[model samples]
Target: MVTSARPQFTAFIGQQLLASGPLAEVAIAVMNASRNPAAPPIIMFADASGQPIDLDLRGTERDVVARLPQPAPDREAATEEASTEPRGRGRPKLGVVAREVTLLPRHWEWLGSQPGGASVALRKLVEEARRANGDADRARAARDAAYRFMSVMAGNLAGFEEASRALFADDRRRFVSLIAGWPDDIRDHVVKLAFSDRAEP
Candidate 1:
């Protein structure tokens, strides 16, 4: 569900942040760091999901960039193409899917009485539900993303388990306190991922 027109990445060498930017930049940075025998292993993470990304850093910068995964088809471009095409449809292509819905007789009667009938009423209800749960949904997603990152990067760190529990419990103070002794970069990234749903103190 994490979609971004321009995806970003963060790279770290051990506990030190190497680079944070687009894939091309991070790939080049990783390539450069790999040359140094003293540098620790480098890891690149997707900023959106806090999941590690493996890049083929086997060639020159241009070659590496060329081998990067192609971006998904832009929704805007698809919409423009659809707009230009001749329309001979009953309803504009809203990408609506028809599905069976079972409801009580009273519910059906209420839906049927709405301004745009059952479909519109159902869509409105669904939208309202989504809006109502938006904050909780975002918080859940942030917790999951933070957990994924921590499981890989901080699993062996002190208080990691307690920090994870506090993360899911939405105890910002306790979570921060638990991770206070972690390396600066790792701790900051964890905080960024865990509290991404709202501004961090």
Candidate 2:
């Protein structure tokens, strides 16, 4: 069974963390609290990624329940049509889609000269590029996510400037030290998001 990605979110009530978890749970909690005027106005943000989750909670409980995942549609019919016939010449067994790719004359010439023609060469090149840059891409994404969360939550807090500097400098220890005095929930959450994939020195 393929597990779906569960994006974590954190909800806040006037700088204080109210709830943190999957979007559906956080949204529902915020929605319920919104019913009471005396409750602090709630704002929800996605973890590390720093994007705000805008939920329209103006619905009945049953309506909200429907938003959660139900049983996936049965794919038994799709499974049966599996491997009866041989693949055609143009369409390979791997289900390769043919799309138009515009290239300059020299580029086309270079690709056509490669083994197994331009398509195979292009695919190999793309795969090689992806493999080479994969780690750096992921690290950059993590840094951006951490920055987003910090900008929204701790932008005005003390040591924020220093923390931001440490973050961009890739100085993990200094960053942790700078944010040590932050609220327990905020500090912990930020640390988890920022350094979850990083190694301890």
lDDT values for all models:
0.83, 0.74
| Tens-place lDDT digits, model 1, residues 1-201 | 333358778999998999998888888999999989998988999977889999888878898999999755655454455557665443335454576999999999999999868876897798699778878777787788889988989999999989988998899999999999999999999898878657522
Candidate 2 matches the true fold with a TM-score of 0.71
Off by over 4 Å in 2: 1-4, 65-103, 113-123, 199-201
Instruction: Give me the overall lDDT of model 1.
Output: 0.83
Model 1 RMSD vs true structure:
4.9
> TM per model?
0.73, 0.71
- Which 10-residue span in candidate 2 carries the lowest summed lDDT? 74-83
Q: Number of clashing pairs, model 2?
A: 0
Worst 10 residues of 1 by lDDT: 87-96
Question: For each predicted model, how many residue pairs clash, with residues at least 3 apart or on different chains?
Answer: 0, 0
Residue 179 in candidate 2 has what lDDT?
95
